[model samples]
Target: MTTILVPYHQDERLLDDEIPVSADITVRSQVPDGDAWQRMAGVCSATAAAVSPVVAAGGIPVVLSGDCMVAGGTVAGVQRAGVNPAVVWFDAHGDVHTLQTSTSGYLGGLSLRLLNGAHPDRYADAIGLRPVPAERTVLVDARDLDPAEVEYLAVSATRRIPVSEVSADTVPSGPLVLHIDVDVIDSGEVPGLRFPVPNGPSTDAVLAACGRLFATDRVVAFDVACPWSRTDDEGQRNIRTQLLSRLAALAHPG
Candidate 1:
């Protein structure tokens, strides 16, 4: 059976409702404050530990909670099983900042750098997983980028595809880990995100892209980030719910 591991804490009510089948749901509510990187790391480490056994047994796809920073632990779990997974990072921001350059100092913003070998001591050494090769990483739907992140993208070998270019033809040549940051969706669609950006991909466009990606058969696991559903805007919540349902359907199509 497949498993959807919910590794979040702040807004449990958003995902408390029933999810689709084709998954054995596992919820880990160890949410850390946005300012606490160590706490976040600990939670992710624990979540990885809990899910590692099942992954070792094989044939299960783990859908972790929507926190981009937790990518470290997910990568650790995949690496422990001896898999080199390609990454499809879907988000508005590149998330390639180091702690030193980050204006917000949000751990989520620094996740991609950790995945791609920036802060070796905190991420690579602590997690016991090497950074994924730049060639194997793909950043999609990115628009709001930091200056440092932009410089990194210009030189890095990771494939960076703008939201406008994500079509059915995009394909990864190896095992894949798909990460979606809801902020990639336009603020009009999901206004609840802490960092909502303007002029992102439409909901249907993103879902279509995800559908094509899932059809590739190379995807081994999926992770989503920053899907806040409790904002004051009811329309945004509706959009979020619809998007989640679409993702669940893609993961469990019958």
Candidate 2:
């Protein structure tokens, strides 16, 4: 397994960060001077370039990124390695919004939808990524959804499941790309979240769900998104560090 670190929040670089990882590769994207969407594409393309060879050589790529959108790059890299994979996306909010549907115009909100073949010109097409089918994608623990997202999921083929119930039997069949946004865990357990949702699953429950996925041995890539705000508080930083450490350990269990 190769641990890859990408220390940026969307297109912007994060400052005063303390993300704990003994990184095998740290992706530094040369974001061209452009609009927000174009810059984001630069980051994802850089990530794809970094992750492709690692997977081609038969090493599992564990990507640590600041936002969920980067998972597109991971998916592209896995495909470049010649394995078409189903996606298991775990997030606090439904990342199913498109440009027109999203009121805030946040690109991060459109992550999962883009992976399911929406807005190719903006994302998938930019990164040379082939969108994964909606039926082949599973979204877990999207307890905080917008009205637009709810309406979309009502008719979409994407399967939704609670974190506690996720396992090999429940996920889509074939190779898997497991993506977890840390905010999916209870906001109380993880401080400094930029968009915290209350009453979510505990850290232990989330880890157990991931363990079930890892136990299947079909997960080719693991994408973990750290979408939290910068915090100098020792307590907050410590909690963040411990949680990430535990999650990383799951991919390298002895």
TM-scores, all candidates, are 0.83, 0.97
Cα error, residue 127 of model 2, in Å, equals: 0.5
Residue 163 lDDT in candidate 1: 58
**By TM-score, who's the top model here?**
2
The per-prediction CA RMSD against the true structure, in angstroms, equals 3.7, 1.1
Question: Candidate 2 — which residues are off by over 4 angstroms?
Answer: 16-18
Give residue 85's lDDT in candidate 2 (0 to 100): 97
lDDT by residue for model 2 (61-162), tens = 889989998999999989988999999999999999998999998889999999888999988998899999999999999999999999999999999999
Q: How close is candidate 2 to the true structure, as a TM-score?
A: 0.97
Quote the positional error of residue 152 for candidate 1 in Å.
1.5
Give candidate 1's error at residue 235 in angstroms. Answer: 5.2
Task: Please give, for residues 1-254, the per-residue lDDT of candidate 1 as tens digits.
Answer: 46565535322324443222234656553544443555555656665665566567765455646577766677776777777787889988898888888998676788887888888776677557678887878899779998988888899888899756654455457777778887888878775677889888887788778778778776666676654544545565566667776776665587
